[model samples]
Target: MGNCIICGKPVDGLVCESHQEDVVFEFDGNSPSQLTPDRYYRGTVDGYADFGVFVDIGDHVTGLLHRSELDRRLESLDWEPGDTVYVQVLDVRDNGNVDLGWSIRQTERDFRGKLIDAPDGEHHPEDVETNDDEGSASAGAAADEAEPSGADDETSSADDATPSADATVPNGRGAHAATAEPEPVEESLAEETEGGLNRTTVDSIGEQVGSVVHLEGEITSVRQTSGPTIFELRDETATVECAAFEEAGVRAYPDVDVDDVVALQGEVERRHGELQVETEALEILAGDERDAVADRLEEALEQEAAPTSVDLLADHDAVSAVRDELVDAATVIRRAVMETRPIIVRHSATADGYVAGAAIERAVLPLVREKHTRDDAEYHYFERRPLDGRVYDMDAATGDVTSMLEARDRHGEQLPLVVLVDAGSTAESADGYELLAHYGAESLVIDDSRTDEEIVDAVAVAVAPSLAGADVDDVTSSALAANVAAHVNDDVRDDLVHLPAVSYWEDTPEAYADLATEAGYDETGVSERREAVALEAYYQSYKDKRELVTDLLFGDGEATRAQDGNLAAHVSGQFRDKLETELETATENLESRDAGGAEVTVLDTAAFTHRFDFPTTDLLLDELHRRRDAAFTLGVDEDELRVRASDGIDVRELGEAIREAVPDGGVHVVGGRDGHVEFLQGEREAVREAALEALEELTA
Candidate 1:
């Protein structure tokens, strides 16, 4: 019998049954079966799994602290591998697996005393340190030989590494410090032993120039230079470009590709203000080594890519209806950025699409610059290509596939995440979406158009308010894009607050208009930006124009600065002049007729307006429709039919009626958020007559 450490009570060992909970046990046993249940044990984090954390209680014994046993969120714990933590031994199963539970007492100071739970017997923890110290003296000497003779600094560093004893126990019951494997060095740390070099992180190699160092990380990207194969290695701290050379214009480490967890030994060199590794040896890690690095990066990326709690910029009901869907889309986009997968935005060629796509670009560019070590990473990682129309057709999909496949073959980039903004919510784009999917690419759609139910299965995330049975007429695609952008990156939330309003043409939401006004843009400012983007969208309808678009929609209005808002006004003047001239001609060429009792005015857009000019066919049509005095307005291009009314037009019903009348014309609703009907050019006259008859019957 003995007395408890905390109380004056009798017990079989050092602590009584009631006082057992007051003590922390240092587990030195070789088997999980030897651990006592319901006692707190000191454990080192071995590695992380999706379900739980593996904690090493002894040299051979490991316990799983399931995520359910954690006091807080598993990802929020901030515990890294090899970190010493405290837990309770909940049970030791017959299969030799140990189950651990959360312990309220994490620090040694919280316990009354520390006991060593050995296989033979239990004893005071202080007694084992004398033996541990003598056992580590040989490793201490080995470490001293590998490093400079700063004996005190070397010993303290060695002391810090002592807790994480090798789980393999290769030395057979060795000292903790002697069996401990050092983690990858975080900063300017250099170590050379008689056996080989120690591990150094990519971030630490900046100062270790001209010296051979070892690195352990996942390869985020790879590029073939003329003289060498450049591999971008990313560790917890940062990514460095590693160049491995077999011969000039030849592939080095041919089997190694992106996302491979690797251990690379190379000499660090400074090239063009960036560090590059000239590889000496490379090994693809497997088993525990790969799992450890993968887990670390997975956790890091998950934390970085997790969406911030950003409330919707405005209280618009349509946007509020699908808030969760917005979050899902944003999370997908942010994760793609973190994983170094390129983002290809395919948006409709319009003022709304430009603003929608630009909002995401503005939020994501800064993150791309921050995540990648290379200066040109933003341009390479993010791209925005405008669609000729609102549909993601085969031509666009084929072009995207060719470029992405070529990149994967040549530079070793992962397949991109295609973001369809203001488009691709209908059956028209399903073939294109499926083509991308076959090539292992995922897509996210944020459109305000009426969604086809079948499209839900085709995309990774779909954020269409119409899916939730809400009217999306007043909800511009830019509102959805900007909201998604805010969630993707919270740092640019201030820059995005006003963008939702700038996308609106006529019925600017009072709340959104107020938001724009607060962000230094009034009604006139919003109009000018909208007009400028509309004008520019026509010029290069296929390019991102990142900087120029950023300046126009999100310009800082300081008068001294000569770009941004100043530039918006300059371009908008041209827009106003060109639009006025086109509108005047379009109005002069209008022909009116009585259909039933309603007056329908028709403008032959192909004959009167410039085929390729500042005011695009759609823009000219919208302006004429807005200025029309008649009850209904129709604009006819070569093979296209456009319709507009004060209230919404049911293009589907009208198209059905017209198609019945002109079955030989091959007339169909091919495009537009509301509706745009198209026909075979050779049968334009018959299609137009059928559309006029359909309008008369519908109005009757």
Candidate 2:
């Protein structure tokens, strides 16, 4: 008999029968049947398959790990063949097939106790028993008969009498009382007291830097660097990296791995501006203690995962239709922040798109800081990329996939949640969405554009006004994104009140305009910010200039020239000058043509307008359409054709008419809700004729 390693109770094995499952076994058996069911075993990856992976438990037994048992997609697994892994034996079939279950704890140190399971029997690390019990008895009898008659004999006799010395004298009675085993019990009690008294949460370790602390948490990830093995431990409150080093490139604490609940005693230290712990001792918490730690973390996470209730900023038809989805988007973003998943916000490169993306970024940054213990969590957890066009194209998705894959390989990061704001509503983005889905990355699109029904199926959530039977033109993407941002974090709602007003170039909604005015932004201020953001957005079309954008949109209000020259005021003047100059030149060179019964204004943009200027083609067309009174305004450049019209013209329908008229024009809608189309430059004459003919039919 021996004392249990955990509770210190006397048992036949090193661990008591009650805690057998908590002990990890190294299988030395020759057959599958010799392995115990519901017990974890250290195994090696044999190979992978489409359905599952084959793991070699020992020399003679192998198990199959089904894909359904994995926590994530099989492709995301960073395991290599022959790598050591941990698995639980679920069953051994009559056909010699061993069924295995996934074990989150991958290393030996993750278990409370480790044992060697042989074909003959089980053996504990501290136990002296063997399969040859009869041979051992014979040898012991021979040794007893050959007892020494010198100093060695005297020493052996003294060692044998030590157990009797600790026993209490029997009472003066006919029956002797049983001797109590007090040392093991006392030691167990002392350990329990010490563990409980010194236990600290990971979040609290920040205040205890330079002091020894005991922390109980689950290891989220384990990485072996050139110098040390870093284990990232996460408790209910926060996560910290614990470094354990024995030698360079050598495995330290070889039994510890990802997803193991352990009680670690270490000295908290600051390493390169981040909180780290130099682990002095680590113990795997098992049985009830492990369950208690897991339960506490789950409870805390449950509370954090609960979505905040949405507070509607304004009552409108568009708002009512997408209110629920807005709340859902907010909830998803908030949950991503808590779970430490990166959020990639993709938006169109427009004034409205920038505002929408900026609002979400502003709302999410604080949550990132609040949720994570790392100072760089904002950069790691959130990113904003502006799309050159109003579609989440294959090119954009491919770039995201490449970067995210690199991050995952280098940093062991979870796949990011792709949040599509002001973009990704059309069928054109279906292929891109499919690529993201294949990698099992969650995607959500929030837009007020006319979305294709197919796009709804492509993404996890689609918050488009047209899907709810609301008019697509009645709402802007910025307005929808602003609402979602407000709900994502209500504390930043006041800062976002002016966003919707800046999104609209022409007919700004009365409700949103009033909200912006109440938030201290007048008509001039809102327009100035809009133009400034648009100008800046063009320069770095891909990067999200967080601080510069914040200054432009939410900066302190001052006169045009004040104590500090306002970026918005300065940029907005440049925006007005460039736009006015372009409008004047375009109007001077404009030619009016009668097509059927409608007046059409044709501007040869390539000849009269600046191609690479402050005002983009889309923005110039918008201004020209607003100022020119025509049935249809067509802007033609060397590479593409842009059309803007009155309320009656459906650009999508008109594009189809043009495609039918000029079969070789290669016409298709490219500019999202703005209703711009692209055509082959070689067939420009054919495209122009088709557009004029289509306009005539529509006017008629």
Candidate 3:
């Protein structure tokens, strides 16, 4: 029996049951079943497979370290055959398959205590009998005589009875430090070793520059430059780049990888005003020591990266139903930022979509800045793309996959988190979501549109009122995204409060409107910003134009004043003029007809209006729908059709009828319930006649 080293409790070994996981054990057993489960063991890297690594624990037992247990990608592992590694014995199945888990600690010295687990039972190193008692007694006498004056004789004797700090044993190498009198080798091997290394955190690394230091952290990333392999290490406090050079254009420390916990011993140096470590030696930590490091990091991350509990920004019941989803979405985005994963936001090219995308961008940029020490992290981390249509089609998915794959190969970047704002809710986007999923990329959809139920299975997180059994009309995409953004980073919640109001063209929710009003954005200001964003969204539909959009929406009084001809006023005027002019021409060209019981207004958009004008066909259709008093309005260009009707009309049903009536017209519901359709130019007249007939049937 012995006293526990950590808690000072009586035990059969150096540690007690509660602290058993605190120490790493070296397995001496010959078979898999002899190995104790839940205990970390030092193992040898036997080989590798596509799925995981094979490790040999002892002469007769081998275990499989599956890749799923790894914290990072499998391709990033640098382990080689014959390298000593630390792993935890997770299980020994009935078939004698020993399942292993990766350990963060690599060296025996990092562990608090060591044990030899044999087929018979667990045995401490001190339990082994030796014939060096006379030598041990002489060493104890020498240690006691050299003790400090204030130390009690009993304490001195106790300290002398234990191992000396410098005593060596089998440490992979058989070399031992010779002394006149040596302590017991088993006790020496069981004790932890620091070896005069200055252990420090990454945040305090600045003070240790020009000095050799030891830091324990998880490798966030590894980039191989022409000269050195740069391993980006992040502890709880901060992240730093450690450069290990074998030679020019050669790899260094080939066994290390991103997410591998390692004890790094190096000299801190300043390169280009950034702190980097010039690695002298890097060791991957494993066993109980590794578990402790991982546990510490996990605890720190839980404390720092967890999203704050959201207080409902709006008090609507519709918003309350999916409050958990909103928080989850926010947390996912935040966690992605901390993990250095790039975020790609795909939103519809509409006012509501732009507002929603911009709100997330605003919330995420500050976090990117705060999390990464790199100057260009904002650009490297976040990207916002405006989709040409509401659906995230195969075309869009292909483009995203192509670009992200290129980035991965060229820059060694992780695949981005694809965030769909005000888009990707319908079944039409399923193909796109699947493409992303096939590549192992994560996706999120936050929309207020009526979505198909199948979309729930296609995405990691889907936050839509329709999916939550709430009325889709009760909330706006901007409001949902704004609430999510507020929770993503609460510091910018006030900045995003005005966004939901700006998204509404009419009947802005009183709760969100009041929020905007309190934030000094009145109805007129909101309208101007909305109109301006819509106009600008057309010019360069692909680019996010983040700064320009920010200036247009949240610019101060001086920015809005006409003295400088602010972007908001200029674009808003353009929007009004273009929309009004289109409305005038459409009104003059309107052909009124009675279809069944409802009044229908049909405008030949190709002949009467400018097709290639500032206001798009969809925008013009929207304006005409709002101004006209008919039960249903239909706009037809040469080959395209746009329809708007009261809530009583089923656009999908109308579309189906139109397809049946005009077989070769290629009629389908293009927009989700918006009633847009397209046809071959040859079938325009037939399509128009068919649409009129279908409308009459629907109104009946």
Candidate 4:
């Protein structure tokens, strides 16, 4: 939708009757250049200068003109600011200041200059070329008299006899000349057209008189400045005066009721004052519709009337209640896990500061333990020890060495043990399931449902029998046995979505109150009002941060801070760091930031990788990571990666190979047309391979 220049509302047409009288000027279409460095001036040229002419526009503003930029004829003209010049608005800076641009004395010849030697419309030049008459001597004498002499002797004598132009200049004439005639040729070039119609009433379409037209907005003011009472209605559009109270025969006096939520309809008419609807035929809507309108108004007011943060924190209980609700389901699963015996626990840290394995170990283990032990089941625990390396601890829980350590130390062999995982563990998937299945161990994965858990579980369980065999070797063969023993449990499936990854500061209201009180705001009824305000604020901030991080990658910058000076730099750094933390944990597909500084991303908590949603948080982060890697490839220092990530997503790793790849400094990689990656430095194959590797664990 195209926006109206005056009110910024989207409109269908630019010059409809509703906007005919609106004050507007074209920025780029009519003028060759409109941007200005000079301020608005109703001034004249002070004097001509080498680079430009300086015009003293009254007080202190000076308009400039370069000698090369001006017409040569203006060099002899004495002008100053008091002489008006139409300066165009160019740049409006952050400091609420403006700059203007101006030009001096463009003539009609300028317009004709674009045409090749077009004749002047007066016909004098044509006559000069075609005249022929009388005796030869007489004709030659006549032609001699008509011709202009190269010297200006006669014109000079006439000018000497007249008053000086500057001394007798008319009041405001110089100002008018400078401003109005800045582009003299433009006026002649414009083709004027006669307007065909004037504004007509809506009633002309045969609408009933006094029928309600359904308008909603605030009443700005009620005044009787011009004999008749007028009420100004201000909507999203510009304000319009409604003079319903001025009309006779109407008891409806809405103007007297300030800020009233009214539903009114009346006949459109022109009064002595302004355009208004006659109140005599007005109707004030009643009943359910009126109530609904009032309700909507109330909601709007509430949204606008949120209280300070300090007040919210002071009433911590309410905030705490909401937090409790958000995590209740996850807590139930955590307790269930601890009770499950011989629960296979696996753990790994997400790049974001979250522990992923604990969810499975904490929630489902207890239930398994209790259910098995209650049935008098002989439960034997086994720990899988990889012979090749000590990296197997990547799948261990916090305190699992109590009984298993002694058995492993003494016998170097043990029965198949249940694997226990921490909340948000890295070993939940990405071949972890396949490895576990090969060892013939009963495997259970704790995972956020939004990620890989379900798929891995189903695949691993399909080979359950081979997994349970005594001689489990070569991961693929035992996979079928592990699948048969471990059917996907409905209980476990239902528990994933409710897993609590988020913590609510139940005591937030109090914290907010303390913060607000320290800031010195009006604390009246601050506690109750603060909670409502803070919750709404937090959500909004979450949304905003998400958008901002996304923009940093795409270069859209719609949600980014203004790219001016150090403020942008500082903000970018702070935002990148925060988003990095979240991205590392979730490996989310996308992320965004809200004004409240929350980092919301939708990636798995264990791996720092996820599918990239175009124009989403994940995409932005991926782009930044790609850039940082590129920079490293170009010989840029890893520390600078911090700054580059500030351009969008956070970078986690900087390998020596990447550093070497960037010959000059930092390697810049760009997404390729073929759904692959290429180094902007042109090392296509190497960069594509690296990007593919980074994306290996991400799901489609």
Candidate 5:
């Protein structure tokens, strides 16, 4: 038997199962079957095919690296015959065909170690034990691992048998890894006690660098990277990352996952300014011990997840109506942060949506930092995604499902708590909510749009006050979300003070306007920020843009007011210029007619204006409707129609009437409260005329 070259663990070959991925292997095997699947190997370019590139593994084995598996297009490959490349063996067919996959790292330096897969390369532990010359923290670990399993014959106490003999460890970190001050790994080797290993909380390990410690906690998550399996462990104190390398890109402790209570012993090390545990051994806890750890964690989470007290930013009847529901929404978000379940906020890509998302983001980010021990946890724990409209349709849900599934399957992340802000209240999002429900994922809807009651049962939390007979018009989504954000953390209550005001483009409430003034933001400041956000929200509507958004809105830095004003003026200027251009074009082509004493104006958006431009059709439509003195205004596009009424009208009822009048018009209502309708492109002209006739009927 040989031993692992790095860890000095006994194995049948040069490397153990855990360290196999750490070492890059040069395939010298005789046949395709001899090539181990899922392991990286060095290969030579034999030639190229229409479907794939032919790569030679050693002398006799040649495999096909299919173009579909490549990161870039097959034709863009810069490889020539006989040139060396690294690849992963994927499969070996019974007929002698080999399937190879792409390896992101092409050079030997990208790997931690190297090994030759030759028959005569078997190595003993002593022969390959790292000498003191290499400056590795694990240098002495290899020697200690080599000692006979009958180690009980030597040391009486576990602490006395500690590896590294309390010697100073030199830094051997790469550019990606952080090097802690050189220090002897503390000699207090954790010993098994009645409660398991000597319990050490994650928060306490910051000052204990280079120490071998025992930690017992619930595994919040596990991420498989190119190098190691990072198990995020959470005690009552805080969550931390414990890396256990089994194989490069392979799961370390496969049985353990999110929420599993486990005990792990490892050396604490610093990586990229973050404290991480280099796991030596880890196992799932069971029975009484597991129950105790689990209970402790649960108790702490419940306490941390609840808000102390809450007061609304203003006394508006619309927001006050759903006060209890807003508190519940706040609790859901807080609980998600404490349990390390990610929070994904999907909102309409509008000024109102941006304000709502920013409020929650500002509130929850601080809690994430306090709870999660990882430095980069804030980015992973909270994300804001902007959807095109207020409906979370199947198209949006499909993207969400694909992302969450990959994270759960590949990284062992707990299914996120998907929060819909300023969106997903309508029954149009039913299929999307049901799809998430099918996977046991929880969701919360915080929209104020008119909705069918069926959506209340579809999600975990529905914070739509309109369902409770509250007026939807008086409440902007940002007003509801700002209340929820206030309840999340009292510390950021001041930060959310202006968000509700910023969300309202017109008719700012007296209380909110007063609050904005007290917060040093005049009416112009709020409008500048609102217009600025609307412009930015349109361009890259998909990305979170966390840092930039935070700066534009909250201004976490000291020079924030001046900087925020400067940015707002610059971006909002572009917003005004684009919007005015569209409004000018739309005004020239508008057609108006009187029906039953009501004036109805129509703009042919597809022909008269930029159908898909900086100011989206709906946005431009809103401006035109506001400028007109008509009782109702309609924006008709190639395949869709949008309506605005002085007194809000029901688009669903209008769509039904239109469909009855023109049976082949293909008019279908998209959103009831928003007065959005869709039709077949071929039936646009008929649908437009039918819509006008239907409006005349409604007026009559």
Candidate 6:
């Protein structure tokens, strides 16, 4: 027999009228006595709900509190798991579940007010008397609802029913006597260390021409041919070309200007055409410093051209040995490692440790082995180990024991190809791969994103996408398409380093439709190259804009100036190189197919905006002026033309007269809708020359 939990009363022979007789309450038969309730304790809560909390609270019974019965501020408290709270008895269900209420809210208002007025008995004896009087009145009313033999049926003694002499509520709020204050919040701080680089401050790398110091800037200019690639960087004073190299790595912003602020961190290089320092990281700060530098640069551009002499004897002598070594096998391997190829490491193609197909290994092995330096290739043994982040070891010599990750701080200094392992989610496979990634080797974690075959195919396409289309399904083709896309992206980045502000031409559905009508491809070779070409064009145009901006804003003593007008030439050359590489890889993978069917796609754009860093476009206006001079020999009075253009006066005769005033017989025409015109082929130049001769009569 369980005892009444609330009052600790014996319950074997006892039954209360409202509870324990049956599941339902009865209006009669038992005395009108309140049941011995469950232990009802109020707990501090983040919030209260009419229904119970989803979590368990020790006993088999769950606890709940009605919304009206809880304190209003209880909802405001920030509570978490394992917090203590206080509660009072309201009503309990027969199943032993408890419903709690707040007694402070249920207490008489007059009694509460008295307590609030005088909290201590010594300070407010009169208030205590008033509280007692109120309690006595409440007790009389409660007795009316009590059992027929109310006084006898009641369990409390006279003193228990009587209000305590010292009990008082402070300021009409609930008594805080029993409730403990909450604990202070806990927080953690990150540790600070020395040598930490600040992004905002300038880090001087070297001196340029003894006139200016070189600094790394955060403003990076991106040019896309097919994918996004960074080109030049805008420093405070001028823009510099960002040279990215596959083997030796990128060195400096090509044409750095004096007082130009650059935020760069890396080994500094200063010699000949490669006057910029190569950086591991760089950031351009924003604010008045940049504006002031730009203003100063513009002012300097107006000065008479200074003698352009470079004193490179010391730098040339210093870089002689290092430049020679940059052409070594080690450099080639370093270049190969930066490609970030996704490799599929299969222990065995079959379940029983059988070797994979020869063609697969033959195609992949050469690329991987190329990353090893001549010395590393000569004596390095085939060892099985988890080299870097989640990489497993599978030896070509003997597929056996796995290994641990070795801590090599110098690993990043060397190039290690990133590879993706294809395996099921077994503990052995996961641990092996993780070990490999930890060893300075990047790894791709494979899940449901793609299937094993798709993963393998992606690797194949990534390293060599120009390969003839594999007889793979649509799913595989889509995955392979994405892989080829990554390669194109990297190629675009590579292209931008060499190319100037090139524009990008996106392959729209209409472009694809046109491409599809022109030629057919193997299911795998669908007209993606068309789209690829368009993307490349877009990047080229984008590069052009950056060059224009740098030129207009910084003025052209900088090395980046040479990159202008030659982007088309560079793009054509690079496109050929990329195509050759892709074609070679494609042919190698598709030995069964003939190469005669292979073809290249060309892409073009109609209109593109020139991207620049400033508001002024005088460079374009100047070019227009030069063209104007070549086509027409006559010019109208500046004031007369200005008034005519402003008042919308018809000047077709004047335009013809200007066209006829040129020395050469060139045709005159306007390209844009807004009255802008140009001189072209025909007798217009001669007519303009004759007209100018006539106009000279007035001046003479």
Model 2: per-residue lDDT, tens digit, 2-39? 44444455565445666565568889878998998888
TM-score of each: 0.70, 0.69, 0.69, 0.20, 0.76, 0.19
lDDT of 1 by residue, 1-700 (tens): 4445444354555667764765689887787878999888899999999899999997788999999776344654667888888888999999998999976445575354677777755565544564477665433233223322111342444223332221111111112213454354343212232247777866578689878788888887777643356788887666777776553335787888898998887667665455667675667778887898789888987787778775888898999999999889888898888788899999988999999999889888888787776656777788999998888888999999999998887777889999999988888889999999999999989999988887899999999999999988899999999999999888899899889888988888899999999988888888989998999988978876767787788766563246543787888889999999999988899998777877788889889999878798788877887777777788888898888866667777777887898887778886534668888898888877787888877788
Q: Give the least accurate 10-residue stretch of model 4, judged by summed lDDT.
A: 110-119
Question: Who is ahead in lDDT, 1 or 2?
Answer: 1
* Per-model C-alpha RMSD: 23.0, 16.7, 19.2, 31.1, 10.0, 31.4
Task: Give a tens-digit lDDT track for model 6, residues 427-518.
Answer: 32444444444453433322111222322322211221112232111111112211221222222222111011111112222322333234
Cα-based lDDT for every prediction: 0.78, 0.75, 0.76, 0.29, 0.78, 0.27
Which candidate model has the greater TM-score, 5 or 6? 5
- Clashing residue pairs, candidate 3? 78-255, 104-285, 104-286, 105-285, 105-286, 106-284, 106-285, 106-286
In angstroms, what RMSD does candidate 5 have relative to the true structure?
10.0
Best-to-worst TM-score order: 5, 1, 3, 2, 4, 6
**Clash-forming residue pairs, model 1:** none
TM-score, cand. 4 vs. native: 0.20
- Scored by lDDT, model 4 comes in at 0.29
Clashes of each: 0, 1, 8, 114, 2, 71
**For candidate 2, what is the lDDT?**
0.75
lDDT per residue as tens, model 3, 1-700: 4455434465654457765654677776777878878778889999989899999997789999999776344554667899988888999999999999866445675354576666644555444322144344332233223322212345443233332232222211111221223333332111223546656888788897778777887887776653356777777777777777554335687888766888776677665455777775677888987887788878877666677758878787777878988988998898777767789999988888899999999899998776665545677779899998888999999999998886676445778899999988888899999999998889999998777888899998899887778976657889999999999999988899889889988778899899999999888888999999999888888888887888887777575556657668788998999888888888888999889979888989899888766788778777787787888888889988888776545567777888998887777776566436878898899999889999988767
What is the lDDT for 133 in model 5?
50
1 or 3, greater by lDDT: 1
Worst 10 residues of 3 by lDDT: 169-178
Highest TM-score scorer: 5
Candidate 4, position 649, lDDT:
26
Candidate 4, which segments miss by more than 4 Å at Cα?
1-341, 351-356, 361-435, 448-685, 688-700
**Model 2 residue 119 lDDT score:** 63
